[model samples]
Target chain A: MQPFIQFESVSKSFGSMTVIDSLDLTIHKGEFLSLLGPSGSGKTTILMMLAGFERPTRGTITLDGMRIDQLPPHRREMGVVFQNYALFPHMTVAENVAFPLEMKRLPRHEIARKVARALDMVRLGSLKNRRPSQLSGGQQQRVALTRALVFEPRVILMDEPLGALDKQLREHMQLEIRELHKRLGLTIVFVTHDQSEALTMSDRIAVFNAGKIEQIDSPHAIYDTPRTRFVAQFIGETNLIEADVVNVQNGHATIALGADLAAKVRSGPELQAGQKALFSLRPERMRLGAEPAGDNSLGMTITDCIYHGDHMRVQLARGNFTFTARCERLAGDWTVGTQVVVSFDPRDCTVLTS
Target chain B: MSRASARERMGALLLIVPLLAFLAVFFLWPLWTMVRASVVDNTVSRVLPRTAAAIVSWDGQGLPPAQVHKALIEDLRQAEDQQALGETVRRLNSAVSGFRTLLTRTTNAVRDETNSGAIDLGDLDRRWKEPRFWLALREAVPPYTDRNLLAAVDMKRDAGGAIVSEDPGASANRLIMFRTFLVAAIVTLACATIGLPYAMLAAAVTGWKRTVLLLAVLVPLWTSLLVRTTAWFVLLQNEGLINGALQVLGITDGPLPLIFNRVGVVIAMTHVLLPFMVLPIYSVLLSVPRNLMQAAASMGAGPLRAFWRVLLPLSLPGLMSGSLLVYMVAIGYYITPALVGGANDQMISSVIAFYALGTANWGLAGALGVILLLVTMILYFIYGRLSKSPQLLGA
Candidate 1:
């Protein structure tokens, strides 16, 4: 099936600074896509360009096989929700939700019906007469969502729509919005700098770095197998240690950390020998026992232990390098300043050279 | 209160003292004095003396008795025969004052002692049934007659005190003030309509476009009202640039009579006050988020529709503020209309000046002034109430 929307070699710049650089992305219909990045990493810019507030410096944006880059935002038939809700300040909640219908000049009765249905969808039907000001932050966000959804547009674009709410309400709104997206099967393009929100809400996340798509995939794949060093360092808690590839043998590359410790890393691609590589590993994948485990082994002293609610994080020190290990079941109580052996399976460490 | 908050509050109060002083002395005191002047007859001097027998004595409860009114009318007539309209113009013209002319009827007509075009009934001592004295006495009613207000409108109700045609030949009603107010309302509405879009457009534009539009709105602001009015004068005067251009373009054979007219006054006033319209609206529009427009645009409404639905409604506050500012300024405008408008287009401020400076009838001037101030205050209040809820400007 044709992709719902495609950004083909799309790039955007503001004066000397580039916001989006030759980005290529495909948003499938009925799919929830999250554009995730740091604050200035062009994720919101991409969403804005897609929503037609900003145009790409070069290249075409196609919606369902036809070019939509030249179309003005209103004619594109996409619903948008802003961070601050952008509810019409002068209008009541019902009037704000009824605005698009009024613009379409729908019959008053149908507008009333649709407005009721939309407000009820967001669980705000009873408070329809109240202005957006009288509503709480979460309620205002729900009103904005209903406003966007009322017109039944083809796609819904949300730019940090839940950023204004507190954590509890934000989490609740996330679930509610996700359920709404599913029920409507509306193609959603959500932009946010919060990685957890993107992970919780998106079917596919496009991780942005320096005005380009560093990697785009399911959240699990993006976290477990990062294509670039920037993506690997950005997604979740990671321990990236610089090392030189000593040798490649039997599909596993041995990386030499120092004169004392040499470890072999397993990654998807066949890595060549003597190349400088960054080894990325999740702290949970390591075993904190005083024994060797396969070809990946290291000696270190226990520097510190952090008792997180779910697990204990053990900090290990070896030479000039420090690494963390998550030991779920603490075995043989180990104190700080105790010498120990930290072992890990070679397959857990992925190598990204750039 | 904490020391800093206290100091800041004190500083605010101190800063406000000058504004309060300015308003109290210049705006409020004059209004009070004008109201005082309208009620008390102090033609002898600015004092009520023990020799109240010489005054135009009237019972504030009912009406003046016939004898006191007789003395008052004879005294005023003797003063009119002496050509003493007021103390100031008596001192102003060295040549015109000494000579006598047919001014008693004009003075009586303007003062409401006689109905418009009605011959003066000379003696109030006669019986009330005598038609002549009865007509004049009937015209002169109570402690405070709205005679000055009528003179301002150039209407004098006849002996019955009902609004009637002043004369078969003389146009009883002025109709100029109504025309002036209509013109002012038109200018205000025009400014709001033309300026609202520019404000919205400026809000959307950024960097160079925004700076350019701001400069466009502000260029007339920086120029003095007189300079702008004069520029209009130069352009509007016959055989001046506009008519010259029209003639050169073969649009007309004769120079258009554009100067010293209502059209010229309106055009010049609009040019002078467009920035007033733009600034309030621009400030309000600037504070409005662009995302609102984007959100509305993305919500399946076309750009114009979204603007009408979302943007314009939100911008009503700015429009109201701008119109109020422009109208207030326009109503009190003196120099622009004086330079550009004809006799028929002079507003209340000009008439107030005429009474104050030309005739030096400070009593009449003060009365007109109180009316203008009262109307302006009322207009301001009505505008505030209509703009929105009071909380908008932190009332």
Candidate 2:
């Protein structure tokens, strides 16, 4: 199927400073794509551009098959949820939800029905008569959601919708929204700076940096097979260790950590003997104080031990450098000041040249 | 029980007492004094209140009483200080020739006080007659009559000459007050209608254009009332900028009558008062969050729809406040109308100023002042109630 929304080399600039560089992206229909980055990385700018609030200095955005860059915001037919909820303080939840329909000049009864359905969708039916101020932050957020969703726009854009919520409510709303997206099969582009939020609610994440997308892929693929050092560093708790590629005779290459620590990676064409390389490995993939589990292992001094109930975070020191690894709590025995070996499967680490 | 709590409570009370005292002295005390004056009866030594502005011991209605006739003659005779009346009429000649007629009628009517006065107050009450007052009681009686102020609105004393509804319709009509209220409301609505777009432009634009617009909007705010009104006078004058431009453009070869008319007064007052509307709405619009409009648009509202449904509705608090401020201030305005309006176009404030300054009738002035205050109080109450109403608040 053709992408529902496409950013075709869409670039945005303010005066001379580019806010979004030449970027091309295709948002598939019925998919939740999260644009995740730190503040000032221009994730929210992309969302605003799609919402038609911000005009791109160059290039065009296409929705369905027609170019949408020139369309005024209201005609674009997209839903947006804001971090502050943006519920009209003056109007009751029902009135706020009914506004878009009212603007369309729909009959009163139809607006009432649609508003009721939207409130029910957000589980805020009882709060229909309450003003935004009368509701809690979570309830207000739900009201905002219901208000945006009442007219049934084909696509919804969320700019850090869960940012204003507390941790528990944010997590609760995340699952709720994820379920709604799946049920409705709505195309949603959610923007957030919270990595966990991106991980929890998205089918795929477009990791952004300095107004550019570093990687865009399925959540697991983004976490497991990040193409660049920045992506691997950004997505999860990955330990980056730079080493000399000492040996590469077979499909695997040996990466020397020091006289004390050395590891190997599954062979790749880019790996060369005597060349320096950096490898990223998830802490959870390594077992501390264990015999070599797979093709690679490192011996180190135990620096710190922290119990995480389900897992143990074991910090290791070798020579003058330190690194951390995790193992199942029951499978590992690690104590501070003890020398030990940390082992991981060779397939778990990715060798990055750039 | 707790030191911190005690300290906080003390601090709060310490903050409150001065403000309470200031209000009591400056507002409540003076208002109480005015009410007291309105009712106080002048006795052998002092004035004693029965109710505000209703201290008529003389029940002069229906039939003539000798002492009331004498008192009426004395008061009217004192009012026609032929020398002062001449000067007063001369001063007003430049402004209105009707002043000279008013002076002549007042002088001639008092000269034949017994033969033909407008109304026979002496007929309404009897005890108003006294031998000393028939000869010379103006100094002893103490000049206090609320008649003229009530007369300004076409109301007067009851049969007893105590302040009461004079005309049957006055109980419902409040004619002059209603007229004043209507004018104020129309001006407010007109200013808000014309000023909102300027405020929106000020809020939405940026760079040099925005700065210029902002300065333009605020220019009137920084101007003195005299200068602003003078500027309007210049623009609205027959041979002034607007008329000259119109003539040059061939809209009319002859200058149109623009100044010294009701239309000119209304136009100038609305222009002068427009800043009051624009500032409040502009401030509110500037503070409105950008996301709400975007959210509306993203939810299928176009730009105009988003503005109408979101921006405009959200802007209403400012609109309400601005209109109320403009209307309330306009109701009490005197100078603009006094200079630019005709006799019929003069508002309640102009009448009050006439009684207070031009005529120097303190009792009547005080009564008119009370009425203006009451009107202001009623307006404030309505504004407070309307702003608090859920429907308006929602808007």
Candidate 3:
């Protein structure tokens, strides 16, 4: 099927500065795609371009095979949830929801029925007469969501919609939004700087770095097999070590860390003999013991041991590199200042390049 | 109430004592004095107390009884002895046109004669035989009458205690009052129409542009009212820059009648009051979140619809306050109208000034002032109630 929205060679520049450069992306219908990055990574600019709030300095954006780059924001037929909800303070919840319908010049009775149904969807029906100021933060967010959806726009854009809520409420709202997206089968493009939010809510996450997509994949694949050094460090905690490729074979290579330390990692085309490359090892994948059991193992001195409720974080140092390893409490305690062998399976380690 | 709370309340009251005293002495006292002066017709009763008392019961159809005549003669002799007859004559003359000369002629003829019954007052001045003169005296007899208040509205009570419009030959105060309100309303409307968009632009901009716009609005407020009015006077004159520019542009074949007219008055007043309208509106517009407009657009509203549906209602309180400020100030404006307006375009404030300083009719001035004050107070009361809502105060 053709992509629901297509961004073709889009670039945005402000005077002497470039915010986005030669970017291309596609969003599928009924998919919850998240653009996740740190601040100033041009993720918001892409979202703004898609919502028709900002125009690209070069190239075009198309919605379902129609060019929408020149369209004004009101004519774009896209619903957007702002970070602060942006509910009209002068209007009540129902009035705010009815505003888009009224702009469309729908019949008053149909508008009222739709407004009531939209409020009921957000469970804010009783607050139809209460102004935005009277509602709590979460309720206001629901009202804003209801308003954005009440007009039945084909696509929804959320720009850090849960950024203002507390952690507990943020998680709750994320689940609620995901449930709504699934039930309605509405295409959504969500932008957030929080990696965990992207992980928890999106069907697919596009990691952004410095005006480019670092990687795009499912949350499991993104966390398990990050393609670049930036992505490996950005998404989750990992132990990275610079190693020289000693030998390359079919689909795998042996990497030498320091003297007497060698590990097998999945190899990329950039990994050649006697060349330096970074290897990413998950903290939870490594185990501490006196004897090595996995395909790859290394001898290290335990520098520190931190007691977490579920697992102990064991810090190991070997030849100018420290690795953090999460050891389950079921595993026997390893004291600090003791030498141990840390081991991981070859399938769990991936080689990353700059 | 508990003693401690009561004592605390007393402390609060004590803290406000100086301000309350200041307001009473400076504001309320003057207002009370104006109200009293508007109705206090004491000159006639004070000078001719017996005659004033006698005429209250007299049928106004004919001349007052002989007893009233005798009392008036006694009062006139007493007033002449004290050298106070001139004041009474002047006061009575204001009510009826020729009373001062008539009273002076009769008093001069009767002053030296000791027999109050021997002299025929009608022979000295046949005008005394007319009951209209007596009716005028009776009109002024009451210590407090609505004559000044009625005259303020261009109406007065006739001899039969019926309210009637004052003589049309005299100046019509009601027309002046109507013109004052109309001019104020027009100036207010002009200020809102021009200032609203200017304020929105100023509020919507940022950096040096906003600063420049704000300074442009505020700098004019520092200039003296007289200087500004004079500036308009120079610009709007027939031979001045505006007419010269118009002629140069070939918009008119000759100089337009711009100065000393209603148009000039409204333009100058609107310029002066525009800042009052703009500042409040700018502050309100600044407080409105920019995201709301974006939300409106994202929800399928055009720019105008967003402004109308979300922004305008939010800024209404500011507009209301600005309108009230412009209107109240415009109605009481004196210098600008005096400099730029013609005789026919002069507002009620000019009339008040003419009555108070030009003709020394303080009672009439005080009456017109009371009316203006009452109208302003009523408007302020309504505004206060309407703005008591916290939503109007904003989030």
Better of 1 and 3 by TM-score: 3
Candidate 3 wrongly placed segments (more than 4 Å): A258-261, A289-292, A296-314, A318-320, A327-341, B1-28, B44-85, B92-143, B386-388, B391-394
| DockQ for each numbered candidate | 0.52, 0.55, 0.56
Using TM-score, give the best candidate's number: 3
DockQ: the better of candidates 1 and 3: 3
**Where does candidate 2 chain A have its weakest 10-residue lDDT segment?**
A327-336
- Model 1, residue pairs in steric clash: none
TM-score (all chains, Cα) for each model: 0.83, 0.81, 0.87
Stretches of candidate 1 off by over 4 Å are A15-17, A103-107, A249-251, A267-269, A290-297, A305-314, A326-335, B1-19, B44-146, B154-174, B219-222, B386-395
- Better model by lDDT: candidate 2 vs candidate 3: 3
- Rank order (by DockQ, best first): 3, 2, 1
Best lDDT among the predictions, by candidate number: 3
The window of 10 residues in a row where model 3 chain B has the poorest summed lDDT is: B78-87
lDDT of 2 at B240: 92
The digit string of per-residue lDDT tens for model 3 on B1-395 reads: 99999999999999999999999999999989888989897877888888888888897878877888888887777773344456778878987889988987777766766654567778778888888888889887889978788889998877578999999968679999999999999999999999999999999889999999988888768889888878887898999899999999999889998889999999988988899899988988887888888889988899988889888998898898888888888889888888888999988988999998999887899999989988888878766765566776437
List, residue by residue over B1-395, the lDDT tens digit for candidate 1: 89999999999999999999999999888778787665444433221122135333543324445564444344444454243345322321222332122223433533564443333333322232334332233233223556556555555666455875455445322454566567778789889888988887888888999999989888988988778877887888997899999999999999988879888888888877888888888887777777777777777677677777777776777788788888877877788788899987777778778878997766667766666667678878977776666333211
Backbone clash total for model 1 is: 0
For residue A102, give model 3's deviation from the true position in Å: 2.9
